[model samples]
Target chain A: MKPILEIQDLSVEVESKKVLHHVNLSIQKGEVHALMGRNGSGKTSLSYTLMGHPKYRVTSGRILLDGEDLAGMSPSDRAKRRLFLAFQNPVAVPGVTIASFLRTSIRSVRGDEVPAKEVRKLIREELAGLGISETFMSRFVNDGLSGGEKKRLETLQLRLLQPKVAILDETDSGLDVDALKAVTSRIESLRSPDRSFLLITHYQRMLEAIRPDVVHILMDGTIVKTGDASLAKEIDEQGFQSIHEASAQL
Target chain B: MSPYSTTTRSTRKNRIESLPIPSRKDENYRFTSLSNFNLQQLNPSIAHPPKTVEPAPEGFQLAACTYPGGLAIALESSSHEGLHLSPFEDAPEAIFQKHRAAFDLPQALDADLFANLSAGRCENELLIHVTEGKKITQPLFLRNFFPSTDQAFYSRTLIILEANAELELAQEFVWDGIESLIQPFACGLTQIVLGPGATLRFSTVQNWNPNTEHFSRTYSVLQEGSQLTLNEVHLGGLKNQTRHLTHFEGRNSQSLHTVTALAQNSQQMDFWIDAVHQGVGSRSDVEVRSIAQDKGQIVFNGKIRIEPTAPQTAAYQKNPCLILSEGAVIRTLPKLEIQTDDVQCAHGASISSVDEDQLYYLASRGIPENTARTMLIEAFKAPGLRGVSNPFTKSWLSKNLALTEEEQ
Candidate 1:
């Protein structure tokens, strides 16, 4: 089957500085791909470039979703095409409540096929499933929320949106051990044959729970290593330094 | 005859004559100027014809209604006892005495030029009084109508609640004539007195014609253990200036003041709030939010003072503004004065255009860019209306804010 998402030699720049150089990747339907990279390795640049952030310039290459070019599409338009990104640091909106935000996003993506009243009901249930208080629905979006709480709210959006290609950017960085387990469990529950996920992180801890089918190591704006799930275990045991040595020899 | 119409009028007119034209050089008027308003050419005696008063809505008992520049005053009959509402000209001697006392409280009338102008040439006055220890279940409604004409209009109102009394008031201003062809000016004053342990929820909605210039002053005095919440919304007028002053007079009194202004086109709006804490353990919260589009301009000046006598007082003042267009401007000035050592007082102001990151966040969730901008702009003003305690006031403001019924 054709890949659900493809990056054709994507080279990206930020403020006229090249961050990602001729990078290429592909993810088939119903597959989990883990992109591991150290700090300053352009992990976030790829995610932002995919979402059409104005600050991140795409110097070259193409991003395809089911064989369709996504270049020049607004983030909202890309979202309607079933692309979602969970940010490492979510922005806080002081007066917009979580329920209101989710409802609006759902309506925008779903195009009013789902009634607002029904969407509200679903939001309440999802919030409760995450062990968040019902009153959390009334609080401002991510305002005054703890790091763990922000991650949970992002997961809540993922469940509601059910996007075709979901990118998780450092979602496990701020979480505690217990929170990591709970969040990964939620992510594992949403796995299906029709959805694809790209989990981006530097640690193998989260990979142990979600168990990606394929793993890629990015270093200095290039993917130097690609292998099966065993590659992630090998890096976890010997650390990234071993991979650095092996890739240098390649 | 009332002394306010006879003796006070002559004195105020003299004061006005001596007062120089307010220029941008003055501290209070530094961000604004009155030169383009053409105050000298406008006539103050062009009266509006009388208008018929509509019946009161359910859950409200109308006390009285009056057209500002008209010669008629319509009094609605109410079956509720201990509640008195009437025109100032027809009020009994006792009510008149209370009005006189209320009108004397030190407020913006002390030095504000527009306030003095309103007091000197008020065309009519409304008086609302509730007996001591009486809690009126139904709110009192007052509506003031003005004709669309190239003239000046002035009005005044006085509200008095006796000890332990409770009342909610929703006051609205409406233009009653055809679409105006010429500029019009209006000046109004409202004085409120809350006795010991009394509570008052007051809201004022001003949506005058686009060709109108409005100056409104509301002064409130809170006594021992009394509570006051004031919500004001400004959405119209070519040039508008609003002054709100609340004095905490007795121990443990509390006050909350919220002001919201939305300006588009070439409209100019100035909102000023002053809260004086003179009583021990008193508290005050003042918030002002405004959004300006096109060439619109908005100015907010908020001040809170905690006197030596006001030990253990807590006060906060915040002003947040949004400028949606390149030509739009917003100026916010917050001042706090604390003479007491144990008092807690703080003030802050923030001015910015629509936040790009916030818009991107919403847009990333599938909301279009235009819709996201609108949503963020509306959300910025939600804090100003969150503290409203009166349902009628909340509903009135939500309607003007274009909030859906589900959102409210």
Candidate 2:
């Protein structure tokens, strides 16, 4: 089957400095792919480029979602196409409440006004499943939230949005053990034939919870190796240095 | 008949004639100039009675209504106990003698020409009084109607709350017609006095025509254990200048002043606020929030003073402003003159544009760029507008906030 999302030789630049050079990747339907890299391996750069962040310039190649070129589309447009990015660090909006923000986003994405009561009920249910307090509905978005709470909120959005392709950029970094279990369980439950996920992380703990169909090792803005889940175990036993030495020999 | 005697009126007119016209060179008028106002339009006359009127909000009684030419009429001798309104010319002799100073205008014409101009041209006024220990259940509402004319209007108001009394009051300006060919100028003074252990919540909203000019002054005095809350919203006018002064006279008194304004087009708004702590253990809080678009300009000068005799006082001032357009300007000066070592005083001011990262975050959530910008601006204004004391006024502000389009 054709891939659900495709990145073709995407060379990205930020502030006129080349960040990602000639990168290519793809995720088929229902498959979870793990992209592992060391620090400064351009994992975030790839995620931002896919999401069409204004700062990340696409110097070459194109990102296609469902065979549609996302070249000149805005982030909002990409979001309408069921593309989601779980930010590693969410920005704080001081006076915008979480409930209002969620309602607005749902309405915007669907291009219609969902009934307030129905939206409220959906939000309450998702929040309860995530173990977040109801009082968080009134608090400002991400303001004064602990790192764990921020991740949980992001997971709640992921469930509500139910995007076709989700880029989880280091979502496991700040979560505690219990929260990690809960988040991974939700991600596992969300797995289906129509959904795809690109789980980006630096470690193998998250990979252990939800096994990936394939794993790719990213080094210096390029993917060096693509193998089954065993590649992650190999990297965990040795380090990226061993992989770098092996790739250099090729 | 006018409340002021002839001799007093003549002296005020003489002062208005003798004082030099304010120029931009003056420090107080540095950012503002009188060139936008037509000084020759000062013929104060009585307003023609309106053919119809808008009813007051539920749970509120119309205390008084003023027309374009400074004519104030008592609207309702309310059935609510302890509520009263009297024309300034017809106040009871004893009550008049007791609180006469609260209605007088400024003596320093050189420092306050506009106030003196209002005082010199004043025709009629209103006095709102609550008797001692009377807790008014219903809020008293005051309405001012501005007629479509080229003439300038002036008015005076005095409010007195006896010891242990409680009152809630609101005032709003209403334009008489849908449109006007000429812009009318408005000048008015309002003074409030709270007796020992008294409480008062006063709200005022000014949404005038964009071409109109307005000058307003409010001076309040708080006695022992008294509490005063003042909420003001300004969303209109061409060249608007307002002054607010609060005197914390008696021990343990408290006051809160909140102001929110929106300036669009070429509108210019100047606000001066002062809080003087004179009694021991008094507390005061002053907050101002404003948004400017197009070439709109806003100036806020806030001062807090703690006297040596007033030990252990707590005073705070905060002013936050947003400039939506590159040409828009916000100039704020927060001053603290603290004489006592035991007092706690703090002030802060911030000016910024819409945050880019915040916008991107919202946009990523599927909200359109325009919708995200409006949402952020609304959130920035929520905390300030939430301080509005009157429900009707609050509703009006909310409705107009959306309708007031950004001037291109």
What's the DockQ of model 1?
Answer: 0.76
Q: What lDDT does each candidate get?
A: 0.82, 0.82
Query: How well does model 2 score by local distance difference test?
Result: 0.82
Question: What's each prediction's TM-score?
Answer: 0.94, 0.93
Task: Kindly report which residue pairs in candidate 1 clash with one another.
Answer: none
- What TM-score, to 2 decimals, does candidate 1 have? 0.94
- lDDT string, candidate 2, B264-333, tens digits: 8999998988899999999998888889999999989889999998999999998899999999989898
Residue B157 of candidate 2: its Cα lDDT?
80
For model 1, residues A100-176, the per-residue Cα lDDT tens digits are 88888999998767786788788777877787887888888999999999999999999899899999999999999
Clashing pairs in 2: none
Candidates, DockQ: 0.76, 0.55
Model 1 docking tier (incorrect/acceptable/medium/high): medium
